[model samples]
Target: MHKRVTFDNKLLPYLLVSPQILVTLVFFFIPAGEAVVYSVFSQDAFGIEINFVGLDNFLFLLNDPHYLRSFGITVFYSVAVAVSALIPALILAVLADGVAKGATVYKTLLIWPYAVAPAVAGVLWVFMFNPAVGIVAQWLRAAGIDWNYKLDGDQAMALVIFAAAWKQISYNFLFFLAGLQAIPKSLIEAAAIDGAGPMRRFFTIILPLLSPTTFFLAVVNMVYAFFDTFGVIHAVTLGGPAGATNILVYKVFNDGFIGLDLGSSSAQSVILLLIVVVLTVVQFRYVERKVQY
Candidate 1:
């Protein structure tokens, strides 16, 4: 039998929890409700007119080629950001875990990047890759390669992907380092005594033990790529160079805020919310099967 904590005063429990409940209702549910309402109604830029259009906003999005393109770009961008962030961070974490001298300093330096804001990270990269004055771009031009992200769609996409991934790497690194440290030293030593090499031991033991952390980070990284990188894209490219880097989140901003298509933007946002929900559910349902503890 499970024992439940009893509250002497009935009102006390509700009072204790009231603030959080009120905050959630006001910020989350209320905004979500407003977005849903706005999605079904067409509104002019000045908000002088808001006509109920039923599902027309959503239908327009379905028929819009730019919206379709943004959807595809979002998938690719999310995958690339997740993979790039996870793998390099894992490698750095593993190396840092094995470090004995200056370990604290090493980890501190690695974690510093996470403290930088996404917009700031974008600006930093933009300066480094600016075709006219950037050091990296100048070097590329010297080597006979065109390095103008402002003019080249592929280059613009690449720049944003790398910037976003770089920003997330420190976060993934922290989690991975913790996960690495949690593995039992005895298990690793036993594996070594059994004639397992470092690579073999990692693949056979460490990787399996780290699966749970890996799965959690994967879900978080996907969500980050979907929503949190908006600042990066906005600051760096503004989804420019022929909309090459216009992932779904940025597209919503571009359409709603920049293009002043309020109804269409709201529809896009609702769709994005649904996509995130579905992706999270799928991750828990299928991906969690691989998680080991």
Candidate 2:
């Protein structure tokens, strides 16, 4: 019985993690391997050709204007959303930590938008931006503001980026709140004793201590803006108005599913995967070096 119990204890960790491992293999690793295999070969709707084209797809992507534009647009969108979301999340977290009155109420109100599905949020934003029926649009019209997302490219991009950033604010806040809470009050008290001002204590002690959490949230927010905002774009913009809001993921969807150009789309996906993996690895490495614990 002792030996059996020992065997079960040894196997317990693996048993607990097996479902996650299997899901990763099935959904991520396997599909990524197959995508690499499929990227080297061109196939039509009927799936006839099996010829090895080597790096032809990649070379073609390098020369393709639309692919280049899509890559640039994706970078711009990712940066825009990250900066916009990070600033507000950081400020809100600090305020929530300091405030004595109705902190829970403020947190609950701030996090409410996170409960709304991305697709639903996109639809709601679109409804609000509608020219005729939207309350926002009506207010804009009454104020003599000419806000049109359909024809104008810059305005359209701004609207999409704002919506995407709005969706992520709550997630960022949650991570930041956890980080703030994890910080020991003793440290702050010591800083106060040493004549450190609020701003000084925050920049010198709190910031470095919060490095791990900030790194975590940054990677998460970047990846979310990169891969998961497709539903919002689909519901709101559909990459419309002269392809202004078409980021890489949406471009991949349009190419692979809508246009049936799987080879090019797979190549694009591989590039995206490489970018994300490199960034994530760098983040982990940087955090491991900086984190106190």
**lDDT string, candidate 2, 154-265, tens digits:** 8778888888889889889988888999999999999999999999999998888888878777777888889988888888889877888899899888889999988888
What shift in Å separates residue 166 of candidate 1 from its native position after superposition?
0.7
- Scored by TM-score, the top model is 1
Which 10-residue span in candidate 2 carries the lowest summed lDDT? 1-10
Over the full model, what C-alpha lDDT does candidate 2 score relative to the true structure?
A: 0.86
What is the C-alpha local distance difference test score of each model?
0.93, 0.86
Number of the top lDDT candidate: 1
| Candidates' RMSD to native | 1.7, 3.5
Candidate 2 residue 136 Cα shift, in angstroms, is 1.8
Q: What TM-score would each prediction reach against the true structure? A: 0.95, 0.87
